[model samples]
Target chain A: MSSVSFKDFRTSAARAIADVRLQSAIDGATLTFRTGRVKALADLPDVDGLRDQLKAIRSATLARLADHLEMFEQQARAAGSHVYWARDAAEANRFVLDIAQQHGAKLAVKSKSMATEEIHLNAELQNAGITPVETDLGEWIIQLAGEPPSHIIGPALHKTREQVAELFSREVGRTLPPDDIPMLTAEARRLLREQFLAADIGISGANIGVAETGSVVLVTNEGNGRLVTSAPPVHIAIMGIEKIAPTWDDAAVWLALLARSSTGQPMSCYTTAITGPARDGDPDGPREVYIVLLDNGRADLVGSDYDEILQCIRCGACLNACPVYQEVGGHSYGVPYSGPVGAVLMPLLYGLAENEALPHASSLCGACLDVCPARIDLPRLLLKLRAEEVREHMLTPQERLLENAVAFVLRHPRLYRALTGLGRIFQRPLARGGLLRLPRRLNPAGERQLPALAKRSFRSMWNEIKDGQL
Target chain B: MITARDDILKRSKQRARAAGDHPPAWRSRRQFDDLSRRFVDSLAAVHGEACVVPSLEAAFARLGDLLAEIGAGRVVVNDEPPFSGVDMAARWPDIEWHVAGRSAGDLRAFCAAADVGLSSADAALAETGTLVVTSGPGRSRLVTLLVSVHIALVPVSRLTADLFTWTAGRSTPPPAMITLISGPSKTADIEQVMAIGVHGPKRFIVILYGDED
Candidate 1:
């Protein structure tokens, strides 16, 4: 899940922006998700009220998360599931690997799961000599291509049909046309079906865990979630500690909003709530079930200012609505969680010093807040992260000096005006056609033209107008 | 690991010291006068087929017609309350049959190779046209999944107003797996193009019968 450094955010974003295909894919997919979100929310009667209710549920649940977790563990264990608590990514991966080794699982089929991706479980499983086959078409495509998912819901959104065709053709040892989408889907189904049937263990991530019933809810449009859990002898579900609801009542509201918010559907085709392993007389399902409650840096954020970050349901709605995310795509964030959420989370979950630039990746447009089902205050958190960065003296020396100078100038009107005047005079050397064309080394914006400041200051213009010199 | 669990929970409790208690909100309910009609309409909207039959005989007829339409020769049926009295194998002797826990074969292999899976809904939601099927003593999850077509026999009496209504009134512990099948398996993952029947059933047909008591 680790990629290019967040300190190199500008370089990564610039590279993504320069790729026409990446831009087009991001534009097209984000637009679809954005419009779809609008329509889906509009169809509901009083969506704002629903969003508020969901927020309250999330807030109330998190306030007493330990209680809920304990309850879930008791109930899940009673229902024949082994619940493991992992302090961090390494522990979580180790538990999964142990399960795989215990079952002698040479092949493991996986459904689309961001939690698994966040921990880089596939790489660990591969190192342990288990072929972790991704069953979700988008995840499978990216897995085959040796690339990370560019979108949360639509993992292969960055890849074009022609590229997919090439990938499929290579797998099948034959040439295939790009335009035949159904055929491509058929090919995936045929290949993944075999993995599903033969795999000894299946791994998935929980969308939400219900404490009342000890059920882990998984929503999927494709049936891979079902196949994964049902086909294997052992099923392992990894869930972030935050993904919990106290009761079935809370799970209901989450299910109601999740599909609509993400994919514009009233509900996804399948919403399975698995309490434990298969029952005694049940025909098919995993014999052993394991629930790994992952608390990787989340336990510390329980009552922090950024605690609301845990409210995110991984809908990818915020990603679609973010202007910066739409421009540079998910990979630019350099984390499994991307977009506005990633900006705030990556810095907090990882160290702020290592990922200092992520919090500033946003334009603070608040489009994310508008469409967020949980109504998480993302922009406010981003601001808090930025303030923390400044407080910790994490910014570069040049950036700090520039910020201090600007702050000082803004404090005194005379100094601000004088500095502006001097800047307008000094900028002439690099100013051309009403834009600043600074040398490549000196230009911070890099490839983007900066509009030259007006010849007259707004304050001076206002003063002149007041003197009746119109 | 246990020590980690204790430490994590301990920190979480300390941090949550300032949080106030909030009682769970009672969700406002949605009402539908004709729930069965709404159920059918909702199911149709999501590419699922649903029909209201006047009697059990009519439901059986509809199921037979659906099977014939899908050209399903080998069917796996769940042995539950709704399917108990019906000797499906005796009625359709020509078609191969495998009943959960009753059939003499490997249930997984039978389901994976079967053309149709038959089960009965424990409950359903009118608002979303979702059939709630649970795995228990006589029921098999694979009887609904791992087939080309899935036929669910849902009685009208089992219909609830919506998801909230059903969840709010829950009295017993959940089964091993409670599946809410809204429609046939689908995916728009590939360039946002909708493709049906990815891994589960391609066709989901609901036979709604047995009027409310």
Candidate 2:
């Protein structure tokens, strides 16, 4: 929604990041999530085996995605529901807007959903002259501030309690105190409750779509997602094409992993699996439930080298484990996503042209890959994106030429070794010890420190080798 | 106002089920070993707790032994198989085992009633330190939520290295809900200060169940 990815990372972060915020906000948030994942996974040391299984599962599922989709459609239809496929963002927006217009709806409530963010659903609905409210506290905060989410789980992670108090006071025309989470929460509840009672339409994002049952799985810490889907008659669930899983059991594992990874909760507050509207004698449920499967280039991904990308659960664990993301925050990636997965996914989902710099944003720490429950090879995908960006010539001319030269030299191991040796010898002045102080190529390297290289090249020393080195 | 609200609710259900095509048949779990490997590699990176014992008896014995050694008095247990053998009251007359199932109260209360919480997993991954639990008639989502010390028993048959392999198919085996427990509840909320069991369980004990138990 901000559409300001080009503002440069530092400039944007400096403008947004609050100084002297809660250490728990950073440490507590990251560690709680990290530890929950640890406890949940104490028995399975063979996650690689699981990753393999997941890979096989995703491939098989995606392979027959169309078939399964057809089955899910039939099942969903049989159970009395509607499924809409959006080729891209426009189609999704049009569908939602048209639905709102048809219902003559003026009020709408939404839960936290990345797919809606992908399609910019709120703006579209607004453009069509309808009010779409984000009911999640985090999304609500950011919505008021007019910024994209900094963290997937905590959309308003960028905001401090003080900032929230200020925002809330202003929004509600009341003087609210800063610092207490409950009081602030109470204020928010009072406000959103009014909307919930008044809204005619509710929107949500599905955690997992069970094809067999034609059920949409929704996991949430707060009760907002449930209310958004249950209270309003018109419930539109926007989910990515990849969120579909085989059955209830698989959705459970992902659900088990999701909240633990995202918020360190053993389980979220609510897990709603709505198959059709309400059962005939059901006391509560929406009258209508629409599932929008947005392709938005995912169909292409299913057939590409990045097919593993489809296995992503969007748990936000990758971002939390990401050092670069911790430092620069989500906005720095200049996309809806801002961590390692974001670096790779945004470029792929959106395109190289829009997010070329994101792939190179990480240190290739492999932390994202390490923490991913789905176990997507994030770094490999990252490298591939960088390479593809070059292949596509998305980089500036100078950057392209430089990148090409590096690639050419790297292709020939012998030449690369020779060039590095020669450069090290000739560039001794730039090297203090084992480290190169500055390459001199980076004019503004003052902000960054250069790494020192090994004194004597390992290959050269090894050629005049010593056997039984130990 | 209420009339329009009801109409929207009526319409939204129709929207959720309108399908482009039929839903595919559910797929079965395949390639267990490969799935386990990937799962372990991923968990090892996060520094999650993992233990692979040879037998269920050994795992439970190890669990009970550890609890006794720690002086933990009462215990709570989920209704998973192989749990019947863990006679906590017989071993430690002071120890109590609260049945973990639906109609459970606040997680803290359930956890407070017992010193140690033991749960039998729906599935287990040998590669990663994870216990998968599914929602059922008896199992409450809270059994895994509130305990200070949580113990999970995993069967070898469910073990896998790859997380992807299990996720491949359309059909997930019985157990409507599946949950994966890796280690004790942990939090790093305080200045990156790693604290175990901030909100849930502080101590995490695992039992890797095999043929014997």
Candidate 3:
């Protein structure tokens, strides 16, 4: 919330994950999402082939994305839809803000969108005196609590229903019983129904944007996304630059994988393909529609190692699958994006100089890389971020000192050999049988027995104690 | 406001002309099918679906008695093939019948209007009891989606092993929305209760028929 950049947002997310409550939350979410996804995709073997096809399609689409944008603009224009290109978050926010102000939208119903979250849209609108209402149950819960989303799909995964009951009781001005889920659903629904009916402008994010047709694809289990987009006469869709697919078929391929992977549903309850503003004789759809294509540092990724990051569909499958994210939730990432995808992406999109700690939040466990639907090499990018941090001299002085001291001790062969010889003598008291029981003060593993050195150094024993090996 | 967007687009057009479009190498379904076996093997190795049934009739018989047992009435039918034959007025005179058409009511109005729904499959996969339907008949998307208990009439010929057969741009053409339905709509977003048809159809029954055997 302060000027302190996300780069300073350092936490031992890997170590902190050992906490029982935190581990239980992450373990529950990750395994549930992962197992459900595995089941959903299990019935369709062609889905993997489709994923391969999409990998090529996504890479190809990202490569000449500027051209795709042009084609999409032409198609959308031809269909009587307005398209705006925003070079940054501010530009994107201003574009939508202007549209909302023009409509005099007293109540704006918004579906859950990480893109809008990234731009701080709700706050921006409130500052301008327009009420931005979050329609997703998880998002609405988070909004009322005055917090950001912690999970990609389930925004309010951080809070229990009991906590929700208290929050609702205060807002609804009644002591809503939280003994059961039906009460929770009824309480939330009673509140949102009013907002949906009153809202004049509706905003949403696209799962995949079809360039050939200039349609926005949205997959949601809750029908709020559909209601918001259609019930309101003025509908605005804010999408990241990388959301484009050359055609609808490509979009379908990704949609099939997305729904099955994200929530393990055969497909989302609603998969709406909105092409343009309403036409004559068309019944009950937004009369005025605007599509804001946001760059937000995506253009900078065009020719860089992080370019693979653009293949993401914003499904949040990586977050659900990442062990670290399951424990700390999304807020600990201290950015709009989170989890394995966020580790590589937050630095690139939000400015690496301010988000270096994001990359260090992972275990390099490679489980995230394994589960990514887009197959972005998350571990590789995290290592790349670490390298960048070391180059920038952004690491704390203590870490620098430790690394320097270790390097100095190891650089000289004589000193290294002599130190090992001396360490063996000093460690005799701590040695039990063949294992060294390290002193707790010096080593965290002290209580646990550590493997002792061989009877003789490798140089004096079996041959070849190579330099890199040591 | 419209004029400003048009002007910005006009300028963007000039800069955009310099870039090239990216298109991946796409092969015909015939070519893809030959290699598709290998493709399915890889997917099966990673995330395998449960055992597959080749006949839709087998799936239907398993579901038909179940639907009768549930005491569902007021059968609704979407405007599509195979199911276009199920007559609501003639079959059960006492039970109300609704057909999805231009005059078909909207989701909220009709979802509660029907207790049972009949739909025709756009395509069926032998590898799974999955039914694929497109939006040519708008009723197919909404009725199958909104009905409480839905029944699908699947022609055995439409069942294929490879998904590319349907997704690789169909030549005969069906409708606007291509929906591949494997099972009934289920959700776990609220307390992870596996609720069926919270927003879509709660139950699915497939009437698969083949001629030769």
Candidate 4:
């Protein structure tokens, strides 16, 4: 795995919240996705039942993942595809590099795949002197801007039209209008068409790998997935070990829910299934096909308490439905996978100590669970991580002391009352109207104002009312 | 040293739990009284054009009119059923037609510059207005993918209620490649603005013929 700098969530979230343009962009994109999901799910005849069916399929698949994988390997090999296993990112990258070297490939066109992003494959290819081109419009935009993807489905969601126009103008050596989205898209199509045709290898991430036929399925709205898999002579697909569908029946359920949850479309424009390399007498398609099953910390998660996290299909509904994610955006999570899924996943994939702030990023909102097609209890997992953090003593000394003091006071009502009395006296100077305006240096609430203490305690009021004193 | 495959498999097996019974196959309750109308409406909802014709001959006539309307100079087609025996070059002598796997002179080159790509769908879904195309001896994946305009002739008999119905009805293993095309290629990556034909066909047309040749 490529080492990403651990920018604490507080710092990045604060920075993101302050950017007005980014805030609106995040708000607009997430709302669109969230609303689309609601409407799309409503259109289904038995969405709840469908969700349950998908969940059961995922659980059953993960339960016997090793056996399914072996079966998949046999079937895929029988179908003339070479299957390789990578225990970690290093192994996966090495396998890809060897393939490129063996083929003497110079250019590789890629469709959007988060698994590749997780392993940072492009950088590895770049170091080995092979040019990697991102063919997805969002991914391509971010690639040109030299930035990490902020959204899983829409990698360039954080960028505005004006910013994209600037990037395209610089690339084409001409000033393009910022508001003309069609013209910008056309420019991208014209430029990327050349790369697609000239590329020697094509790399994609498998959305689902079917064990029945040893097929790798790719879902995309644009036809780039088809072109990438078809245009190149050598096609390589890298998938996480957990992304397996035992049969076509299971794959059907997955496909039915994936698009509806992610983009609110009944179905994406294209869902391509590649069984193996091109068949005999086939006029087009790659001659050689490779499916690299990547573990990269996934196998270790199989039977753990966090095993349910492995059931994630990467639909990204949790991100759109998350309150914290909507406000701060994906970059605030400080990893490729962000939002509620990232909060629980990054800490487990990496060490909890290194990503200590992630588990605390959520407000324990269950919106993610409600919208999740797989119904992974993200908030529960987040709580579990928080408990683990406390158990491991990851909190700072001051925070520990504050927690201890608060616990002690809550245990004794008399002590709490006394402290409240003292606090009311001390807070008189800061109280303005109904809000408390603490000094800038002492305020921990940031932009939000604290509520002033009540003039009389609720206990006292209750006692007076009980005595019939109006 | 154990190979990466063996080591990973061991670790996974050690943690593997007992496999439970697989869930029963889900059947869609959505029944379309008229599959063709539903298919047309669903396809149109996603910016795709669709029409129902009484017979295959009428469908061919409609396709000819579409070709004439677009003023297509070059056309690439898949040599599958319904199109295999037809003499496209003789029927339309004014335009250049490249029949995949049959009369092919650089199919890829023709597809790249072709005005329209023509094929027949193996099956279609009424729920989402999707066409499922499979690649085989004569079917090229790019025929329906690479052109600016794509025209698919789907028989009403191949229409299923939805994806669930299609999956449950399948008796054979899938081909080398199977694609479900719902609409013209589109993107909302740029400021959430919808742009059509970023990489694939800008226009997708479906002609549903009722009668078999």
Q: Compute the TM-score of each model's chain A versus the native chain A and list the values.
A: 0.97, 0.87, 0.88, 0.97
Per-residue lDDT of model 4, residues A316-417, tens digit only: 999998888887788877658888999888888877888888888888969999999999999999999999988999888998999999999999999999
Top TM-score prediction, candidate number: 4
1 versus 4: better TM-score goes to: 4
User: How would you class the docking of model 3?
Assistant: incorrect
Candidate 3 structure quality by residue, lDDT tens digits, A1-470: 21124323433343334355545655676677889888887765565566677677887777677677888888777767788888777888899999988888778999878889888989988998889998777788888889888778877766666767788889889887767665566566657766766788989987877788777777666556666666678889998878888876677568767877787755565666666765553434577889998776776677576678888877678887776677666777765777888778877876666776777778898987776777778889899888988888988899899999889988988998888899888888878788987665444322345778766886865454444443
Greater TM-score among 2 and 4 belongs to: 4
TM-score of chain A of 2: 0.87
Better DockQ candidate (1, 2): 1
Model 3: per-residue Cα lDDT at residue A31: 77
The 10-residue segment of model 4 chain B with minimum total lDDT is B167-176
Q: Specify the CAPRI tier of model 1.
A: medium
Off by over 4 Å in 4: A1-7, A438-446
lDDT of each: 0.87, 0.64, 0.66, 0.91
DockQ, every prediction: 0.71, 0.04, 0.14, 0.83
| TM-score to true structure, per model | 0.96, 0.66, 0.75, 0.98
What TM-score applies to chain A of candidate 3? 0.88
